[model samples]
Target chain A: MKNKKMAPIGVFDSGVGGLTVAREISRQLPYENIVYFGDTARVPYGSKSQNTIIRFSEQIIRFLRTKQVKAIVIACNTASALALDAVKDEFDLPIIGVVIPGARAAVEATTNGKVGVVGTEATVQSGMYTKVIQGMNPKIEVIEKACPLFVPLVEEGFKEHIVTREIIEYYLESMRNTDIDAMILGCTHYPLLRSKIREYMGDKIQIVNPAYETAMDLKRLLEEEEMANDETTEHHSEYSFYVSDAAEKFRKFANTVMPFDVPTTNVVNIEEY
Target chain B: MKNKKMAPIGVFDSGVGGLTVAREISRQLPYENIVYFGDTARVPYGSKSQNTIIRFSEQIIRFLRTKQVKAIVIACNTASALALDAVKDEFDLPIIGVVIPGARAAVEATTNGKVGVVGTEATVQSGMYTKVIQGMNPKIEVIEKACPLFVPLVEEGFKEHIVTREIIEYYLESMRNTDIDAMILGCTHYPLLRSKIREYMGDKIQIVNPAYETAMDLKRLLEEEEMANDETTEHHSEYSFYVSDAAEKFRKFANTVMPFDVPTTNVVNIEEY
Candidate 1:
């Protein structure tokens, strides 16, 4: 009787990094139907050009539109850095990107007024995080580093390995001497590397995951818009996964990050749309 | 007077990995023109879905066609893994991908009868290298590891850190006992991580670079087709770089990789095409 609410919320990433955000969304809003699109075919948009990213984002959005999604989350850092504005302009749906949430969290969490941001080359270069934080408080100093290898390490399921830890420390070593109170895991994949990042940066430095915060924001926004599904029916909400390249790899990764069983992951050719 | 050839040979990757291949081709055949498209906007296609990869590949090829490239080279492993066939069929241009040339080289280099192939998830999952090598000699044993982190490390410009060496050792530890005669750097970016990979594997193992081999193959193919550029005049050769995301990063990376100066690295919106 609630107008048979069935439209799914669409979320996209360059690859499995967005799974962190998707997992959080699923956990926090279990009643809502969700659809995830990972452009695994062209994952790690972090180092690409804005135009190519904008095009890829456009194709992905167009494909998601076909699935009848209510809103879109650009869970990829590189895409968010380079193409979020273009995507939002192209689509009338409520669009959310990790950068904004990350900037907000960094601004709120930094006690020493010195905050560090670490992500992919694209995210750091865009200066979006620095701009957003500075816009909030001009006195805050932001030190940014691009930890590009973290995404590949996480996707390869090497999150806890000593080698992965060593790599994280090496990448984070630069941020060590800086007097920063908080470090935003600007890229979603950075959250998976948090254990090592925490060990390297010490317990004092707060590691902010924009994905978790973005999910929380998503929950609040849905409630405010009266679009939150109220169906308390015992049926488990469905999550349909779509990927651009390899379905098997996506499934394997989903098993690693997802809390519940991913019943169906449909591989769709997004470029055709 | 002979007419000067001006159309660019379009080279594309999900990210900067393709630059290695492009560099080799540019060096060996400078007379031939080049135009590179890095989908840095969306990278790490290794763990993506096949359908989406095909879609992305199609879009890239379609975009390249607009530049009227005489030939198309898919420098991205994930795209080559899933979309090479579709790409070849959809486009009339002579298309070259990294898999076959690397496989051929691995087969030729292996003396112990066992060979190892290291690449991104998509390249390993496609099993194209294994099939190609085995097809050459069924007796050759092939071991494949998806070294996803390597791409990010290379992109982040962390090729020579002790931590990177540690990560490489961690990934290659399994290969120590395998007694592989040759190891193929299947991903173009892997070549940049050569020092680390070589340090772990040792001088005993012959490291094969697909990018170099692919360049040779391109040369051979062009000669066979009688399409090799005949421009022998000084300064007649030209190189143009295009990226989907940021122009500054592309210029910086071009400086690092290119043998000659890249006068201009432009950011072109491939999506609009």
Candidate 2:
């Protein structure tokens, strides 16, 4: 009901990995202010139950709303797959998730009509990517693998470690042998491990990073809804971050991922919400 | 407080890993009724901040206290390292943690003055094992390495996987060249990966599991305090399990580890506490 064109865009993930998505949004929409929430305390939502993920997503969305966000992006793929539909209908504002954008990208990139998706167990179990990709192109066949160890491996900062490569080999064994020409890095953290993934999956299998597609989707949506920042405003975008637990590690990680200095974010005891 | 001679002994960890300690208690003190709480929802307290771990530990302890537990064991090593000192004086009843017991075992097993301790970053950073082992014998040198990847790998159920072996090699590289005779698996989850560790570390280095020592310590405390379960009652020990997340996977895991059929446990939304 109220004008939200001037309000900040809300982006969130289970932890710091969503910074990849946040970074893309910042790069694409340089003038738009952003409010990012990382649920650092109870992170890696990929393995958690749908009910718990929904509850956490609701609490985070509610928290983001208080920041007067114009629109919200569920940057984490597991949350996007499991929690997005539940919250999108419940909330009033424009809400977009990484899954659909990722699915679209994978659908568009694949020439062999077969695609591989790597995500958490919850995301794979939901079968959302397969369904979404098939919906866009009925002829496309989707192969989904749950790489449960990838998130923890990435979060552990094992980007170039041999263990990571071994893990990549283990997780992508099925995907590697398949005829799928495109693989979706379905979890937000996977982007951070992109090089390792690219190295293992090889050059033939196009890796679809939903963060870039999700940013483009957001850009299009803002333009379609006439909600882009006013040209005359000369907006100097201010980025704010919030998390459920201690901010030290997340802040440090963000400083590496985000272009700007990671600000002193407040720790919200999200359970209270 | 009401006389609790027949009451259950409370035990808790970040997740189902504490079942090792609980299983140990059941084996050693067969007559004791044990109430165990595994914070499955917000697990892997190893990397969490001290304040957050303390708060979660307090909540679990309070939840356990409601069941009229006579003595409580901080089955999680990170919690023992970070939260025990903060909660021990605050609570009225006797509270014991895994660190001292594990340290004692490591010290006793070590033929050489140098002892190795492997655990989560928070646990290693706390320097609890070093301090406790040194407190017993000033001549002993304690080498602590934080294996941040172990808990997640264990939770992912990759006990004998190649990645697990590679990760084990990566984590134990520092300790492998050292003269330390005994390595303490300081975190509860480490015991699950014991076989792989033994293979990697070899038979020359004695491995210490805190679960067994912690149970022994509890047995000693019960007898010393004159609060052992009453012999005249003809007590049948009942084990009750409670976790914060979905119980199916945990229930399956428990059925495998636990001696008795783990009773249908309720999922408690622990944050409310």
lDDT of 2 by residue, A203-237 (tens): 99899999999999999999998897764366588
User: What's the C-alpha lDDT at position B45 in model 2?
Assistant: 84
B76 in model 1: Cα distance from truth in Å?
A: 5.1
lDDT of candidate 2 at residue A214, scale 0 to 100: 99
Write model 1 residue lDDT over B52-89, tens digit each, in one string: 67876777888888777888888877777778988788
Q: For candidate 2, lDDT tens digit of each residue in B1-273?
A: 225777899999888888999999999999889888988888778878888999999999899989999999999999999999989988998899999999999889998888999999999999999999999999999999999998888888788777888889988988999988999999888888899999989889999999999999999999898888765466688788898987887888899889889758778888877
Output the number of the DockQ-best candidate.
Answer: 2
Q: lDDT of candidate 1 vs native?
A: 0.80
Question: DockQ (Cα-based) per candidate?
Answer: 0.56, 0.74
TM-score of 1: 0.82
Candidate 1 CAPRI category: medium
Assess each prediction's global lDDT (C-alpha) against the native. 0.80, 0.89
